[model samples]
Target: MAASLLYPFVLLAGALQALGNSMNAQLRVALTNPWLAALVSFLLIVFVFVAMAAVRPQPFPEKASVAAMPWWAPLGGIAGAVAVFMGLLFVDEIGAGPFNGLLITANLLASLAIDHFGWLGMKPKRLGPMRAGGAALMVAGIVLIARS
Candidate 1:
């Protein structure tokens, strides 16, 4: 039961990561001003929420449910908005393909470190030589791509 429950969460995480990268690329191409991009992104998010509410209205959750969220919870969306704008601005300097490859590689390394260290309440996993080799290869590939 637990394994089955976890599968969807894993898939969801992967989908979110891919979507974020693609959206970053699109945002870079679409918006000249970072502030405007952020505003537009937020407006779109608001529109989605409003549309959903209109389609299937639901009562607000209890105060405790809302209050239980950490301060960083809200900051995550804001930070992602800023990151997309910044990535768009800088992507030309580093070719988009190479930059995205490097970004994915970096995200993998960071996630591995977080998982291995048991950061953020996650269970620790052993970091083996295979993982290290994979990371090295990813970096080398990024370098080659950027150089070309």
Candidate 2:
């Protein structure tokens, strides 16, 4: 699929993420334990992904392919779990708008730095004026959200 066509899906995914964060916060309260809530939430994700992989029936990676992967590659899932746990722990205390705004601002800044430095094997994209301006605007937006 072309990148243009994926934009709507990305927008939808963002909306769903906001919803998920709120839901997860409630789940934490209902379960009365942060660890248990996170475990149950991630277990559902694991089961769904496992079911999807089983249905898709992709070819298994060869030993050489697996061996060639970076050791940190698997850390992506751990990083995601940290994000989910943050949502479960903090979203209720801080409203969704402020929480998401700060989260997105941090994500944008980190992404800009990653692109600028070509970190993690990504091709370097210079942080030109336009990108910097966009980031400034995002910061302003976050400030407004946080203040409100």
Candidate 3:
């Protein structure tokens, strides 16, 4: 499947992410601590997901399944905390548009590496010419957004 075909959904997700980041930033400001905001977010996430699981009646994940993962598998949650905290820190400095552009650009480059290397059990993908060009174009767009 072509990435372009999935771009719309990804774009929508980006918009939602922007909203979440802004909301979380405000929470950080109100609480006067990024960690508190992250804690609140985690609490809310646990509540919602737990409710969802109950509604759907899915079986709980086995301990063995979780134990099968590498020790660093839990770092993804830590990464989310870092991302949200940085968003809180930089959004006020750079404005939402520029911050989002830079953040998304960084994520794009990191994602390219992750995909190409098949990190964390993901299927390996070649860094083809077209994909590289697309990433370059995204970087150009990010620069333009930041400059504006």
Off by over 4 Å in 2: none
* CA displacement after TM-score superposition, residue 119 of candidate 3 (Å): 1.9
Collision pairs in model 2: none
The ten-residue window of minimal lDDT in model 3 covers 84-93
| Predicted candidate 1 versus true structure: per-residue lDDT over 36-109, tens digit per residue | 76667768879999999999999988999799866666776676665566565666666667667777787788
Tell me model 1's lDDT, rounded to 2 decimals.
Answer: 0.74
Better of 2 and 3 by TM-score: 2
lDDT of 3 by residue, 1-148 (tens): 9989999998899898788788878888899887788789889988999899888987768999988978898899889777777886667778888888888889889999999999988899989999999999999998898888
- Local error of candidate 3 at 124, Å? 1.0
Ranking by TM-score: 2, 3, 1
Index of the highest-lDDT prediction: 2
lDDT of 2 by residue, 1-148 (tens): 6799999999998899899999999999999999999999999999999999998989888999899998888898898788789999999999999988888899899999999999887899999999999999999999998987
> Clashes in model 1: which pairs?
none
Candidate 1 Cα outliers beyond 4 Å, as residue runs: 1-31, 53-71
- Of the pair 1 and 3, which is ahead by lDDT? 3
TM-score of each: 0.67, 0.97, 0.84
Question: Number of backbone collisions per candidate, in order?
Answer: 0, 0, 0
